[model samples]
Target chain A: MPHIDRRIGFMGSGQMAEALAKGLINRGVVTPNQICCTDPVQARKDLFRSFGASSYDTTLEVVHNADVLFVAVKPQYVGAVLTEARPHLTPRHVVVSIAAGITVDMLLDAAGPEAHVVRVMPNTPCLVGETAAAMCVGGKATPEDAELVSTLFSAVGRIYQLDEKLLAAVTGLSGSGPAFVFLMIEALADGGVRAGLPRDVAQALAAQTVLGSAKMVLETGKHPGALKDMVTSPGGTTIAGVHELEMGGVRAAFMSAVVAATNRANELSRMG
Target chain B: MPHIDRRIGFMGSGQMAEALAKGLINRGVVTPNQICCTDPVQARKDLFRSFGASSYDTTLEVVHNADVLFVAVKPQYVGAVLTEARPHLTPRHVVVSIAAGITVDMLLDAAGPEAHVVRVMPNTPCLVGETAAAMCVGGKATPEDAELVSTLFSAVGRIYQLDEKLLAAVTGLSGSGPAFVFLMIEALADGGVRAGLPRDVAQALAAQTVLGSAKMVLETGKHPGALKDMVTSPGGTTIAGVHELEMGGVRAAFMSAVVAATNRANELSRMG
Candidate 1:
């Protein structure tokens, strides 16, 4: 894919906004000088400025200055931000929203049906060049618009295209899944501590184990169950531990967590 | 800091031994010519030889030819293998054992007390250049000997030095933790499937989520809880899913899995 050479801007200079901007800039996908943003918060604006990007005070100002505008505000504020910027958004602009629970229909509704809109649910791992982002095109979004947005996010990590309806499920799996993993790492470290290992070493080992195992799945293109079976010998320590994980219903809980979160995402959309 | 310059050999040409050898050669840290192994299995010997390394029928031939030898036999066969090769193992050779549940004392006792030995617990991710391995030096092993083994294994993945007693915990957490992580990914993928995503996309997202989250924990130098908080907005989707996870005692189950595996590792050692 080609680099996103057009000017880009963000409506909110928050964590997600900064992550996207930083990832794009660091990967040389979009130059820092080609990026700009607006935020009420001084700290966030200052952080944006540090990346060699200019800052504005209002969403309309950012939309006017850039060709590709990103609305990185919270879900509730997405409506107001996009609606306000809708007036300034020209046909040249592609508006991408990273707000949680905000749908493509919502973006199209808020920012005029004529506006090119993309709804994205990107996780925090963008800070580490490993984000798993999902994007959905709106009524007016062109193939070029979708490609531009996907290219922008891919600099941070992998990007998947899905139906807007599946965005909530994406939220549940990739967005919320990280927290579940963090909790698991914490528990694994605690388990190591219980087994007489020092806290730091245990934590390091736990985090790396997850990272490595995940890499095995992604790189090898093998089934997780097959990988798990390979690790579990006829009567080995991994199998013993696996037995406990199975008994504890770890799988069911994760499945339910996603279901509950997806349900909540649907509710938030309905509340809007 | 330097790569292992000596000829290395593996007693068992199994999956792990091949993973290490392949990782080292692929990384260009050690040439395939520097690695040799002996296994009764003809297929295993052919695979090892395909790497441009020599293979032998007897462990004694490998022990005599290589300066740094790895004993990759099963836990139960570690004593017999080492005892059989002990007489041929000259003072110039440093023996590294990756046999689970076999301690330094057992290696020292089985192979003469003067034999230089190091016990390592390495996981399957070594095949992916992201393995989390732990090594403990034996009484007769010198600092140089420890460095050689560590350098050799580091080519395949990261290695940490710890006391011998903690290897069992390492076995529980990292050694067995990959299997637990695979289960989590499977569950997380199932969650996505339940939410209406295609299986392949869901699995990719689940695995990448874990990988990206782990990278954030490792690279950001922030606590996982703090990182989780960074992603969780007030009244957001992530927190809702997290609540369900907490209610499910998912963390406790993972902790218990590690502890159960650690206890099993200790038990296996005791059984020996």
Candidate 2:
């Protein structure tokens, strides 16, 4: 379990911050009162207040109250928020950033050189408590800080610790990958409708099929190819479908998509 | 909960039958002693015995003992097994067949006209307790029989009651869909590997991304297209990846795969 007494704060009380707070409280990792946040939006602040956490209008108050501070603002606003909180940031604070394209160096520059920093890429599915997240610690971060971040993230979903260099690949795969899957599910439901199933039934089955198949891969510890083969009998419908996917170059399409996304992440990071 | 007092029996103790039995036992839908089975393979019978269920040598014995009789034999052997147990099957018996392409009429022909019958199409993910299943009640089946079958299947995963004409579409979407999604997960992982992620890390992340995205659609009760749009931002990595997928015709490929699979299912059903 994470340190329940630790005061966790968010620099921006956005949807992502709200998800993390919900996970922490729901999982009993921390008491609701142990969390605090700052957001300019009145409605967002009220949302945090509904979670039994204090919400403020200033970064300084969150920095003062929080032991672990999350820089949860938008990518463009990350620098400004961290810089505003830099003066009050101390060794007691471990600053974690969920902002896309924000590097550890940028965070350290804005948060002061001595501050501990961790950069994480989490997907939108965090709202459903099924996030796929990955994190890398900065030069100033201790092993304890990494552990704390890992514990907090595991509450919502699976989390991996990787090198900073691989964070772009993580962005391409788990981060942007959810959108790709959503497209696939929609397409599958469309196919079902095309095949004469009612739209609602088709959509429900399409999503459930994706969910179950993914569970097979994760739970069975079998190779996806092996699992596919297990279900594909000779002259069967699965094989027929697989043949169509291959003929249409589905694999190449997915490969190109992931690579393109990774390239875009690289471009954004460079521009940042 | 399913009727815990009702006895369930499998005519053939194959992997699917084992999965269903395990699900019923694990979910407290039924006690192990309420289950019985017969298999030609000694190992399979022993496996059922390990679950504290009775293992019989003859299908007649299972038919006599169980109120709910699962026609779990392979498609090729279903006729022979059902015919052998036909005399024992009474109005009390709800004969549920999970053999692909075997229609409710075929089950009625072999099990006797008076026997309540259901034709179900369930995928291999039943092994992981996340099965996607659909069923259509036969002419002799009562509403009570349909409810009982639904209760039994709900223990394993989601179940839908649909018209018999739509079973082929169900076979295409949920039945063959898992293999398609498995192939996608493998391709996604391969893409991650191409983009510089470790193989294990890439595979785990890819599978989790699929699972999380699917959960978002199911739990949020939102259209997958809407959810996809929610995550995409202007000039972002997700949109970049999605653009590549579109350019490569990923959606059309999926639609074609599901349609082709549905056509194959129709052909197989006709042949049967």
DockQ of each model against the real complex? 0.77, 0.86
Question: Tens digit of lDDT per residue, candidate 1, span B97-183?
Answer: 898888888999988888998899999898788888899988588998888777888887788999988999999999999999999
Top candidate when judged by lDDT against the true structure: 2
Fnat of all models, as shown: 0.80, 0.85
RMSD (Cα, Å) for all candidates, in order, is: 2.4, 1.4
Q: Which sections of candidate 1 miss by over 4 Å? A: A42-46, A54-61, B42-61
Residues A1-272 of candidate 2 have per-residue lDDT tens digits of: 56567899998888899999999999999999999998889999999998799988799999999999999998889889988888888898999999999999999888888989999999888888888899999958999999999999998998999999999999999999999999999999999999999999999999999999999999999999999999999999999999999998999999989999999999999999
B1-272: candidate 2 lDDT, tens digit per residue: 65567899999999999999999999999999999999999999999999899999998899899999998989989999888988877888899999999998888888788879999899888888888889999858999999999899888889999999999999989999999999999999999999999999999999999999999999999889999999898899999999989998999999888999999999998999
Q: After superposition, how far is residue A122 of candidate 2 from its true place, in Å?
A: 0.7
- The 10-residue segment of model 2 chain B with minimum total lDDT is B1-10
Clashing pairs in 2: none
Q: Model-by-model lDDT, in order?
A: 0.88, 0.92
Residue B69 Cα positional deviation in candidate 1, in Å, after optimal superposition: 1.3
